[model samples]
Structures are given as structure tokens and as C-alpha cells.
Target: MNFKEKIFSILSNKEFDNLTWNIFHDQIKNNITYKNYLQFLEINPFEIKNISEIPFLPISFFKTHRIFSSRTTDDYDIIFTSSGTTGIKSKHYVKNLNIYIDSIRNSFEFFYGPIEKFKFLGFIPTNRKDSSLIYMIKYLIQQTHKNGSHFIPYHNYKDIFSNQNDKNIFIFGLSFFLLDFIEKNNHLQQNMQKNESKNKVIIMETGGMKGKRKEIIREELHDILKKFFCVKEIHSEYGMTELLSQAYAKKNGKFQCPPWMKVYIRDPEDPFIHINNNKIGGIDIIDLSNYLSCPFISTEDLGKKINDNEFEVLGRMDFSDIRGCNLMTPHFLEC
Candidate 1:
């Protein structure tokens, strides 16, 4: 089967190890970074039997090298840069934007039903044209085709709440913006209670306060959002620019990846060893949809495996490189 077909097939199947192994072999053969790393370790890619044996490229490599698996070229359709607090940024060169589109669309639909059913409202503060998160939200909003599906500037609470309809509304925003919106529009709680509509309201928080305000625990953040939004629970999105596929959290902070993606926790002290499930360790992600780019990425974030398919982001490692998505200057853009 071809790459896309294999990805589709794996998305529906429970047997992931065999499929993962096949993709790993193919990736090691085609991906220069992976191949070179294996060569450096004197380990033949073909001889590797298990998915766990496959070496993951350090996430930091993206900051230095132009990481890609197929077709070495500077030409790219779109380049997504990591939101680093520092001036330096990690660049992900996307050969085909369609692959990213498929990954986002398919994964989102798998987790949240259909894209056309909900109205997407983005509350991102940055105006960076190259942000992957912004690009994803924009694409989803376009697909929704709903009247109110658009980016909600910090001051524009009236525009979103002014309209009264039964249309399902999904507000995707950074943590800080959502909080700011709640604090500013304290009357929204009463408005939501008055609108006795059957519409499903979802407030999906993409993690990070962006260094705009002091950081708070996820529980406190979600509690405040739940009280203000009059929603049962707060949802979240777990993703990074380095990865094409995303994991979603319906409630709490536990994230579940799409079938094509899997997370493995490796010992922080010993990178080669895989830790037991539910044990906190370094996050190593294998995204089969990242065929053009490197598939195996060792992220600096610390997390623990919930099962074979689920995990939770604990926090970032100490003294790790600051990611662009997590920290944003408050004055530059409103919630």
C-alpha cells in the first residue's frame, strides 16, 4: 500500500505495532536524519524489530537543521515556525500542505464529530502569518462556513455573544485569552443561562498562557472557564508545530492521539529505554502522517502514558528551549 493508504488503514485498525514497524522501516530508509542517526549508532534500520527500537530525532534538531524525510530542497509550500520565547525558532518545512490539511481535518473529525457542524472561533493573540496553530484554526473555520466562524479579537466579545442561535459554537483560544475574555465579560454567564438553546458550546483551550500573565494550574484555569462559560467541562488541544498530527483532550488535560499517531515515554536519563505505562518520562511521538518530514520526534515536554493510545502533558523539562506557542507577550495582541 502507498503512504496515504497505509495511514488510512492504520487509523481504523487496532493492530498498530506491525503497521508502526512498517512505517518506521520506510521512514528510516527515506528520512536522512533518522538514517544518519542510526548510522551514527552503528545500528542498521532494517535489523530493528520493534517500534520502540527505532531512534527518535531530538526535537532540538528542528531549531538547527531543516528536517525532512523525502526530497531535499529549500522549496516548500508553507513553513511553520515554533513559537519560541527566545528569538530563535524551529522551522518545519511542509512539502505538501495537503498532508497537513488531511492530518488536521481527519484527526479533528475523529475526535469532534464533523467540522461543518460547529462554528469555529479563534482567540489567538499573535499576528504571525507563519503560525501553524493559526493556520489550522483558519482552515477549520473556513470549512465550517458558519456565519460567526472567525477570529475573535480580545475586545470583540459583543460580536460573538451578540448573535443568538442554536448553532454549535467552538471557541478555540490560548489559555490566557480565554481567561481574559471571561474576566472582561463577566455577564456572559447570565447571557449563556438566558439563551436556553440546544446548541452545544465547546471551549477548547490550547495550552499555554504565552507569558502574558502568571501561570496557573490546569484545574484552576478550567474551573474558572467552566464557571464563566456555563459549560460542563473545558476541552483542550495538544499539538506543536513540529508535528503534523494532533492529540485532543475532551475534558481534563488527558490527550488522546489519532490512530495514525502514537506516544511513547522514554526514560529521561536513558533515552534508549522505554518506561512503563503511566510512568512520567520524556515524550517521544511517532506521527505516521509526517511522511514528508521526520516521523519520530523526541519532544522536550514531559508526559506519562495513560494507556497504549493516551497520555498527559505534565510540563516542560527544566532549562529547555522556550516554545513559541506557550509564551506570548500580552501587549502585542489581545486575547
Candidate 2:
């Protein structure tokens, strides 16, 4: 089967006026345990059913449970554990590493093919030796015949920023890290004097930002990045521990779900009733790449579903925000 057909059949047992929920349910259910999921779908396959009936496996289980199939050993690599977020502990996943890397490279080339020749300066924390950005940047740097530099400084941004050559360079940092870096070393402010008008020498941040230091507003943060990094756009990355695909946003601060993944906004109180667009509710992700694991993943994050492929991640729901963070706090840190 082709990739698209396999995804469609794996996700839906019966057709529906709304393909979103069926695909969403099928992906998550099958990921949990293929046999159990198939039986559940066969037994409960209706023309339409409320998303409420769908069980929400705890978001923390990326730590607590081994959700992926143990028998299927091929085409999967157990990636690193998440340091985790508030109220939940660290979680683990076996990533279909080849597929994961290829998708990331494809997305990067699509977005950045125009500026294939610019030097890359990464200031973010790479989660693994095989990080998506790290590996992709290496390729882009070589493809363009440019250099790649990772400014790994220990608690000093001034020294790091001072070390740069100041020609055309692309800076990619995690949101919190960038904020903290800029806040401490105000001198990097000089690099902004040079501009790459066509490619918009962007400053991008991957998702793992919320749990850290200060709470930042989207526009305010963008303004800070522009002021500090001297860049026109602040790209934001949309990725989670369990899923392989990623979505990118151009510092416009709105997360547009990639074609391979679907997002649903559910009632916070109900957390499963499919709500109307522009309504604030829980964000549930249905990822096609979760074929080896649970695909219909429901996140505790509240979001607004304005369109089929768009969502605004509005932080966590209920006491879950505080409650979830608590699960991740270290024994020493709690004191």
C-alpha cells in the first residue's frame, strides 16, 4: 500500500461525514495495542460516535507505560526520554527513526531550499545525538557548501554572541534558551545590523519552552527576538515526544498542523466532546506516524480549532497544568 492509503485504512474502519474523529480514534486505539484496538473498533464501529467515549490515556504514560508493540522490532529506534513537563514525569518512545529524519529533512528543504547556502548557527539543546534539526542542518550546511557551528556556551551568552563571525547566519534556538541568552548578553544585538531580505535569516525555537522560566506573550517574545537577534521572523516548532512529524510556524505565533497530523479541540470540562472552531478546549493529536505506537494521542493542552489544519495551543487545562508539572519535579527541586 502507498503511504496515504495505508494511513487512511489504518485510521478508519467506517466512513463518516467527519473523517477527523474516525481517523483520530483508530490511530490512537491501534497504537495502544493493535489487536485490542481492532476489536474495540469492530465492536464499537458506528457511523458516528461522540469523542467523549474515547479513552484519554494519560499524557504522562510516555513515562509510565510502554505503549508501543514489543513484537514489532523492525523500523523503530527507541529515542531518548523527555526531561518531561510540569505534573508529568519523563516519557519514552521508539521512534521510526529513518522515517522521522526523512520527514524533517523534507520539511526543512521545502521551507529553506531557497537559502541553502547560508551558514547555520544553532543555539538550541539537541535532545539526542540524532536530533532532527542537528542532522538536517548538517546536511543543509554541506549541501550549500557552508559551515555549521553550535554555540555551546556554559551560562554565558555574551561570550557566545561575541564569538560569531557576523556575516549571513541563521540562528535556531529553543524559546526559553534564546530568551535567557538574549536577556543576559545584550551585545548580540549588533548582528541585526545586517539583513538578508529575501530569505529572512530567521530565528526559530522548538516547542519545549513553556515549563521553563518566565511566561512570555507571543508578540512580546517575537519583538524581543527581533530586538536581540536582529531577525525579521521567529519560527516556532510544533512537536511532541510521541509523534514523529513536526509543524512549523513563521513567528506569526500560530501553530499550523502539518498534513500528516490532525488536531482537535475538545471541551475542557468534557475534554472529549468535539467542540466548534474558535472554542477553547483540549487539543488532541492524531498522528499518522504513530503506526508503531498509539496514534490518537490526547494532550492536556487546551487549544482553539479554527480550521482543519490549524490550532492555537492555549496552555494546559484545569489543575492539570499545576498538577501535571508536579509529577516531573525532581525530589530535590520540590524542596
Candidate 3:
């Protein structure tokens, strides 16, 4: 079905990228119901002769039922379980996931340039959560280690920072965990001299001022991260568990979508309408890395589009009008 040519053709061309997204988006929005979606997949079933036959499974459907397009379990390199706002588990079956992983690695290289190997610090949630920062950080650490890191720091942020006067250090942290670690260990904070002329460091944290504190100004959070880590600013990572690629912004920064990930702004008043660049609207993402699963996802995030490949994430919707994952569970369980 010329699958390789078809997929790459769309990804390789700027016009084809947007064109495919438009068709894919319309298919989902026009009929997102389970019954209708099955029909859609039936019509789009993988045909070795035709690229139009390849079917993509909607991620939400995985919560209730398995949606493996592969013929056997051995076909998958690994399975990733997606966490919900509630604790209910949803496993995403990945077939030939190597392509997805490679795309991700290449995208990071394209965006951040080359990353030097160094001591890796992880401050991520051990348990299940809707956010996939923990999973993504683990991958980042592994890459650093494989390429060349003196060592990966997994414990005692205090000790890790004590002997860190030299060497290029790369620290990846979670927002809340990092905050608590900093507050408890003031000595670590006091010992570090702010702004070293030759010190090379990168502190990348994902997620935001959601659960940790009621509200945190983006600039303030960036300042606090810089002070605590003795870095310039907190390099924030924007990604979802459901997405194959991640967007990165430097400390106290906004998100810049990677080459493999394309973001679009949909009108807030009408989800089906695409707003002009710079308008705040619902966030839609199309990630080439999400190929093994669903590459297109409509999110509840309120954001403004800056360009073809950049956005300013405004934050989640308020509680008054729409309940989050917890409130929506009843409806899902009913299915």
C-alpha cells in the first residue's frame, strides 16, 4: 500500500502536513462516538496498496478496550500504560514502536541541539498520574547515560549538588518534588553561588503550578527554579502521556513545538473552527512521533498560537464549567 511513501510524503512536506491534519481532525470531530469510529476504521483499514487504508485508533478508546492493529503480541517492543485524572489504568499497545522512539530522539536533537552527558537528577512521581513527565524524564536520563553521563543522580539532591563545582551537569526534575526538595534542604541552596561565569548546567522541569501551589506566576516559578538550581531559568517541557513527542521551553519560558510535533489553535467558541495565529483557543497537536498510537489529539488546554510551531500554554480549564477527569469517570465507566 505504499505505506512508507505515503507517511513520509506527508511528514516531509509542509503543505501535506497541514492537509493531513485537517482531514484527520475533521474525521474525529465529525464523529467521535465509539460505534461511528469503528466504521471509520473499517473504511480506513490498512491496505498495502493504498495509503488511505491505514487506520489510527483514538487514544480514549484504549481506556475501555484493547485496540491493537498488530497480529501478535510479540510484534510490540513495549507497552505503555496511560494514567488518567482518576486512578483507572489504560494501556496503550504499541506495534513497531521503534519508529516512534527514533522520531522522538531525533526531534530532541533538532530542537535542543546536542546534549552533553552528565549527572542526571530525577524528581518524578513514582505512582500513576495523568501527566507523562515521569516517563519522559526516565527516557531523557537513559539517553544521557547511554551517550555519556558521569552518572545519573537519583537520590539526595543535597549530596548531588555538594560536589558539583565542575563538570557539565544536566538535571531533570518534576515541579512539586523539586520545590519540596529545595525547601527541606536550604544548605544546598545557600552553598551555591548564583551565576557562575563558566558553569554549564541545564534544569528542565515539566508540568506547571497546578497541584503544588494554588497559583504560581510563570516568571516567579522560573526565578525560583533558577535560584534553587543555580541555573539561568527552569527549562519547562510541555508534553502529554498520550503524545510521542515533547515541546521544550527554556527556564521561565514558553513552549516551542518540535519539528516532529505540529500544534494548531482552534476557536474557543467553536472547537471546529481554526483561529488565526496569536489567538487563544483550544490546543490541538499532531505529532509524527505518535504514529504507533494516535498522532492527533484534541486537548482541553487553553493556549495562544505564536507561529506554526510555537504556543503559550494558558493552563487548564476552570472547575466551575467543566469537571476534570474525576467527574468524567462515571460516564466512561458506564461505557
What is the C-alpha lDDT profile of model 3 across 1-335, one tens digit per residue? Answer: 11222443344546555545554544344324422454533543222232222233334555665433222334555566754446555665556555555555565666666654455566666564333455555566677775343323335443554454446666666666667677777666655664354457778776664456556766776787777767756787777656666788863466886555667776655454567888876677766545444565666677887776568888875435443322222234222
* Tens-place lDDT digits, model 2, residues 208-259: 4647877776778788877775667788877766666666776576777544
Regions more than 4 Å wrong, model 1 = 11-15, 159-161, 196-198, 319-335
Candidate 1, position 1, lDDT: 27
lDDT of 1 by residue, 138-249 (tens): 8998887656688888786664656667468898999988888878878667877765355578989997887777889899999988887778888989899999999999
Most accurate candidate by lDDT: 1
Which ten contiguous residues of candidate 1 have the minimum total lDDT? 326-335
TM-score of each candidate? Answer: 0.90, 0.71, 0.72
Higher TM-score: candidate 1 or 3?
A: 1
Alpha-carbon RMSD, each predicted model: 6.4, 6.8, 6.2
Model 1 vs truth, CA RMSD: 6.4
* lDDT assessment of candidate 2: 0.57
Per-model clash counts, in order, read: 5, 11, 5
